[model samples]
Target: CAMASLWMLLVCANAAAALLVCLYLWLIAWPRWKRETRARLKVADDATVVAFFHPFCASGGGGERVLWKMVHTLAQLHREKKRSLHVVIFAQKGPKTPEQILAGAEERFGIDVSTEGGSGGGGSMKIDFVFIETELIDLLHAETWPRFTMIGQSYGSMVVAWRGFQTATPDLYFDTTGAAFTLPLGKLCGARCAAYVHYPTISTDMLAMVYSRRPSYNHDSAIASSKLASLVKCVYYFLFAGLYGVAGAFANVVFVNSSWTRDHIEALWRLSPAPTVLYPPVNVEALA
Candidate 1:
């Protein structure tokens, strides 16, 4: 068992090292590509824009639906000369590609929009989606991405908040759900962050299946397997909760998707500095 533990630790350390190395190489190759791509695309370095940034915008969930709705609204707004939007999807690893998402949107909404993979697709006025996962750390380090609003749903949202906190990017972080460690990260980054949370965390819910104390529903498989490992995760969660408090305090705005989410966030961080709300959008007949 001890040898197995050592092997796991070694594997994780190696993976971290590889990621760092990849990030380094990506940054070095970015500038030349940026110059050539921009020249080809004919876009000036800076442009005014509003963006819908979704890190975890997958197929047809509430968050995905809301994001597409936002995109449609932005498209209409731009048509009427009311606004200029440059949507970006900084999706995480282990998700659909930008093209895949674009195809999905077209199929569902009958809206035809295409996104560029890199910073410059040589377009003058249009929304662009850049998929920046671990592979695009070079783009991230290049710091060429324009400032825009970032919207994340579920785990993607939490990751966006965490990345914002780590990189200090000038962005507005919006979370639709999965408000785990993100609030604290948003607060730390000092970004204009908001959460459209669906419900308060299970920690705040006495009747939650997660905290039933009955062994059956407990997700602590490590604990069920071994008392020692379970104890470690418990301690980890407790420590993790403390870190969440620190990160959440950085958010400037907190808009819960439902009353349940608001209550959960409030309960978890009773003294959080961010404002809370239930900001549901108007439901048109088309939505039905």
Candidate 2:
């Protein structure tokens, strides 16, 4: 009788906690987010707003090159069309200003990004930065189980994107970092969503490694060597692949960097709308 009473008390406590969380989100978080988003990104009637999710904006890698090139291309398009386009980059706070990032991009890729509301050569398209602290992401990595790392990162990114978009949802949500988890959130916010998938989160090759009991990237030396460990990891990959497919499905449009990537994504994701292949942006002339 006492144990039954204790179980009921625990259930009641959990239910209360769930209710409180819902109340906080509905009453406190949503309204404040709406107010802040409107205040920060005051969209002009003529402007078309596009948000790019690039958490690692300062890491001037190939992906960063793609981002800068895309922005430049869009700016040129808007110029030709005589339309105002606002590009918002959701990034982590850094030592450099948006102007410095633009300068770095120009120096590296020879692409020009014009400054807005500043003393500089007049550039038509407006650029804005929405800085987010990445402590939550770091904490997720620290706290989550190793076997579920990929899924945790995917879900964590979705939460981060949700928070970032709370103030102002963009007309288009573009994920340059291959984090397809943000697609559903973007769609929820009424934005047309797209993702440039560098690679599928989990590939058939990864599954084959587990299936054949061979050591692979997904498994460490210890796990790969042990038959028992290999079997366990095979189950993990199977479940993760299903979850990844669900996340990829949320994308309204998908762009892949290469034919190899498109093949893998298509085979794995089975997305209804076939992915478009956009060759990686490389400055061959600059290199020459």
Candidate 3:
């Protein structure tokens, strides 16, 4: 037990040293990453179809609403043009199966939601549902997935790393947070990448709030419960910023889901690309 404890201490010490070194490197290279990424931004072609990456977590939340709405809206647009749009819903499955997630989406998004001719949209578009738990690299290596535009929300966006595993590029990439600048979606997906950010991950204001320097929490209890966690998260982010730096720098375009999120994305990243506002849409007319 003593030897095990000693080994654990050594492991922790090594981790701390590595983290410190990485943090220093991130600080020194942050400016360069920003400059190089910005210089490469230019408008891309629109011929490529948009593939919205849907992780479809069983929790039917706002992000899923946004995705379903987007899919429906795009389908409506395509139907009007008498053309079809291609989409791929990328997800990871574990105890919560994809069928369960799909059922949840149906329950929330609509009962008619299916990969087939559902959602009141006709079979004009060929929709394929790929249920794979393989790494993004394996998906790329398999060469079975159709080259379509990629859009991801939350966890789905994280899979953009799969693009890096393959030589193919997406026509367009869009995500609402949980993407955190990995895999250079724009470059790797071979499309214009745009994301709807939910928050500024590494902003001074966030750090302040995290450090319990905010005005709201005067007691140590609040600090210990929440602010301290935020501070610790910020520290982790600081050390790991480089992991996502390349992805952020290589984004062709970006959009924030809310004003609050946009501010944070800008402040924390040190460079804010021309961000567009896309308020979450509601199906009011349908209800009416």
Clash count in backbone of candidate 3: 10
Per-residue lDDT of 83-186 in model 3, one digit per residue for the tens?
Answer: 44554454444466545665676677673334454322344333334344655424333134332112112124445444321222235555543465543534
Candidate number achieving the greatest lDDT relative to the actual structure? 2
Shift in Å, residue 253, candidate 2: 1.2
In angstroms, give how far residue 163 of model 3 lies from its true place.
Answer: 7.8
What local lDDT does model 2 show for residue 130?
79
lDDT (Cα, tens digit) per residue for candidate 2, span 1-288: 999999999999999998787678656765566456545676555566789998777678999988988999888766665666778898876788888888888887788877555211224677788777767445235266465777787877887787678745687889998888788777656567889988788888888877887765556878888888878888888988887777778788889999999888888787536899999887789667
Candidate 3 ranges with C-alpha deviation above 4 Å = 1-49, 82-84, 94-106, 111-123, 134-160, 163-169, 183-186, 210-246, 270-272, 285-288
- Residue 55's lDDT within candidate 3 is 43
RMSD of each: 10.8, 4.7, 12.9
Question: Rank order by TM-score, top first?
Answer: 2, 3, 1
CA lDDT, candidate 2, residue 29: 64
> lDDT, candidate 3, residue 11?
100
Tell me the lDDT of model 3 at 277.
71
Model 1, residue 209: C-alpha shift (Å): 7.2
